[model samples]
Target: MAWNLDSQRPIYAQIIERVQYDIVSGHYNPGDKLPSVRELACEASVNPNTMQKALSELEQSGLVYSQRTTGRFITKDTSCIRKIREELAKQQVLEMIRRMKQLGFTKEETLTLMDKIYEEATYEHTIGV
Candidate 1:
């Protein structure tokens, strides 16, 4: 999880976003145990307190749950995971659309790009590329 701390957002917020991305991308699947706070802090080269804050936010959002003695685990709700995935997908698509608009891409050009991307994705899957 290489993070760009230079972004305008706070470090903890970036950490939270990265973790959420991991969850949505299936890197941390439902019910999977996450690294300990200290471990994750070291891995991310961030302060333990920052990592804890990020984890706390995730727990509050119900994306992760803690066991009294076991540790934090990714939520076991498939629907929650799907919802997160959809929400993130929508956000990314919106951002791309906004950028394309700013760059003077017409609606037709945007649709053409989308179709090209879809075709490439399908072709890659079919050819195992």
Candidate 2:
């Protein structure tokens, strides 16, 4: 998948978010080995140094850990993964609500629209649309 990075935010920060999403979404399973920093940099079209910085930050957060000679691996702690997943979801929801409010949507109206859109999306998925 493309990293789809933008200039609006720091590249390393974007990389962190991408990696976190991959972990939480099961693109990388618990205890799964991650690609090398060079490999990840190539994949994200970023500099190795930038990828290193991002991965280092992830390590600090206990999301990924390095094993001396081996490369980095995703944390095997399911609870930690769940916490990160929930944090990510909350951030997304908060952003969505902020945007909706800016567009003049009341909280209730936004909820209603969200429900409608979700139903439509679920139906589309069910029908293989």
Candidate 3:
């Protein structure tokens, strides 16, 4: 439940991103009830209204839903979750490629670096790095 906020962007936006990341990272599984606004606010050290605003936005985006007498829950739509995951992955890859190019690597060289990095990462993962 780490909350990282900075002065550049609004806190609520950061909350939304963090929550979305949690869902995609399996920290909050599909159909899981989110922590209450007060709880989340406390965890994130922000005003309850800010957390509420963030959660409301998430619901509007169809990544979360609310039920009467219950609470907000992660969307059970696996396809939507998969799509979000894909979008996030694409963002990461593009950012990495941009950085690589800035470091003077050509597209093919950048891709080859990606393969090397991926192999090392996979090996580390397999050995519980």
* Local distance difference test scores for all models: 0.89, 0.93, 0.89
lDDT (Cα, tens digit) per residue for candidate 3, span 74-107? 9999998888889889989899888888999998
Residue 108 lDDT (model 3): 89
- Most accurate candidate by TM-score: 2
TM-score of each: 0.85, 0.89, 0.88
Residue pairs whose backbone atoms clash in candidate 1: none
Compose the digit string of candidate 2's lDDT tens values, residues 32-128: 9999999999988888999999999999999999999899999999999999999999999999999999999999999999889888988889644
CA error at residue 53 for candidate 2, angstroms:
0.6
Q: Rank the candidates by TM-score, best first.
A: 2, 3, 1
Q: Per-candidate RMSD vs. true structure?
A: 2.7, 2.3, 2.2
Residue lDDT tens for model 1, 1-129:
555565566888888888999998879989999999999998988889999999999999899999988899999998988888898899999999999999999989999998998899888886444
- TM-score-superior candidate, 1 or 2: 2
Point out where model 2 deviates above 4 Å: 126-129
Residue pairs that clash (backbone atoms under 3 angstroms), model 3: none
